[model samples]
Target: MAVHLSEPDRLLPVPGVRLCAVAAGIRYKDRNDLVLMELAPGSECAAVFTRNAFCAAPVHVARDHLAREAPRYLLINAGNANAGTGQPGMHAALACCAAVAEVGHTRPERVLPFSTGVIGEPLPVERITDVLPAAIQGLNPQGWMAAMRAIMTTDTVGKGISEQVALSGGTVTLTGIAKGSGMVHPDMATMLAYVASDARVESGLLQAMLGRCADQSFNVITVDGDTSTNDACVLAATGASGVAVESTEDRDAFEAALLRVCRYLAQAIVRDGEGATKFVTVRVTGARDAREARVVGMTVAQSPLVKTALFASDPNWGRILAAVGRAGLPELDVDAVTIHLGDVRIVVDGGRAPEYTEQAGQRVMDQAEIMMTIDLGGRGHDQAEVYTCDFSYDYVRINAEYRS
Candidate 1:
């Protein structure tokens, strides 16, 4: 269970968006496994996808459709990720888009496809297209919550947020939903997410903002340190509110809001990580550059020994220090390093703190949430924070028998 997350009571509806979810029996039974979203005519979108070279077929098709034109429809399914299926998978994804265009009265290129779940399996195009009519016929503005639930594969809770901000001329509302539990070392983004706003935005500017928001949010989180083959984060601006967010001030506010929502969703993924029992935040400060800081933070966050120690509530500071030392920082000053567990200092001047005691560290580790801070003393001002979850026995059991 997630440490501190609950299903949202309500989701603020965004103008120019209609959504619906239905079960097509693709993989799951008696539950929704498919979702369809319709966007307004003037909607503009920006997207960031996984860096995995073996990404799913829908990722390729979605990139192509976005490049050709703004998408009018988003067709997503969970249960069977159309990845590792080679050319046949590409054909299956294209067929699904063509079916959506035929039903929605739009060009095939105006549809973007997304998928998540088990890889190396062929997508059941027939099952998905069979329910397109019902999904389209039942479109409603209040379907965000249902869509959030429908996208789940292993997620323990529905993840979503809604916010309204006053822009230059009017109030613009933003709503977003995400689904992820494992394979969540986001390279460019998370498993699957869609954020839409009713404000008008320039296409190029929206794309740039997405990259910046992702760097501070999704890209910094890890669950099992395994990047999935079907990770995507998309942002859409449907211009139905008549609020033009083009000025510097407006852009900053919008970008900040976007970052907040993305960060919330990213951390929720960690909290609900496969069999996760503890949520951990790893912070690396005083680095020479952002790249090195992230390297150090991620090294600690992804360390199996460190995660295991966290699960066991063990104050094993040595594992963290060893991970930091192996981060490949060529100019790292061992003498200037310091480590802290929450507010309790564990390491000082490259050795155990003279005033530190094991009991103090253990107390911090016993909490449901843990914070580990690593200070690279006397370095340039660069820091990074990475969110992760403790490794537990259920994590192994879940993955080992996943296909069964």
Candidate 2:
């Protein structure tokens, strides 16, 4: 039921990265719930974490470790977010890093820890630490798929992508994986993603690229208008391909490819959203600025009325119009606004278009994928798009019984 999404047939490996997945019994049974990613020495790594004031303990530890030294390994666990446990949570996160360092023969500062799952619970540190040696022993370049599954909590399908971009010197590979289903919104979500490349990139440039790509991808997606404390996105460059992304042309190509992977993963999360029956795209154009456009698009995307209408396959354009009108735009001219559902113009000059018909709107709503465009007249030329999903009966059931 993942809309039009499917698991990747294969994920090409980055030369300087090795991964492994193992069952730690931290939360789930008879399944891998822990993943370890080893990065080559001297690899450049950059990361962005959730801005929530109460971020998870692993986010704090990972940020400190990344600042102190280049990461040699990334330790991740599912089914326990390790957030809201305060000082005790911080110690648990650090203990896991210490265990990884002991087994991998690296400094504790060289390890970054990430966790996702039920919040406000004590992490089973022993469960994860007991499996570190095995995880390291089984590390292989082709463990991308298994790692993707291991890091999932509520995600129904594994989300990942692999691409090869040709530079002037040689071709470099990029592979990324992400997990999320609910508690998703802008400023990051209840998601964790990691992208690795074999191309050589300066540390500063790598961070810049990640921020830009994240703005276009993760930052533009919403599910239920809620953000999580454990959200993070990381980028690692191993330089194993001997391809330098230094030149302007090379930098542009590398960033473009990175954006593609990020966008694909972001959209996949929406397609697999909890109880999602439709993949919805809200595009807001002709705003005063890019930020305004994004704000408006997100407002529409996060509206429960709009989302439930989508789930029911209802051609209720009024829900969308109401959301747009409340987007907090000043001096807004309702008569200048226009809206479209798929290729059908539902609203023109701020009211139902004369040529519009319920049958035509229903035809578009009945599809598994939908696109809604709102034109804010000629206020400006800026535009933005937000990806979301419809809410269904299962969404409520899934969260209501999540702890059970």
Quantify how close model 1 is to the true structure by its C-alpha RMSD in Å: 1.0
lDDT for model 1, please. 0.92
User: Which pairs, if any, clash in model 1?
Assistant: none
Decoy 1 TM-score against native: 0.99
For each of the candidates, give the backbone clash count: 0, 0
TM-scores across all candidates?
A: 0.99, 0.99
- Local accuracy by lDDT, each model: 0.92, 0.95
Q: Evaluate model 2: give its lDDT.
A: 0.95
Question: Per-residue lDDT for 19-127 in model 1, tens only?
Answer: 9999999899999999999999999999999989998999999999999999999999999999999999999999999999999999999999999988999999999
Give per-residue lDDT, candidate 1, residue 85: 96
Write one digit per residue (lDDT tens) for candidate 2, span 163-188. Answer: 99999999999999999999999779
In angstroms, the error of model 2 at 258 is: 0.2
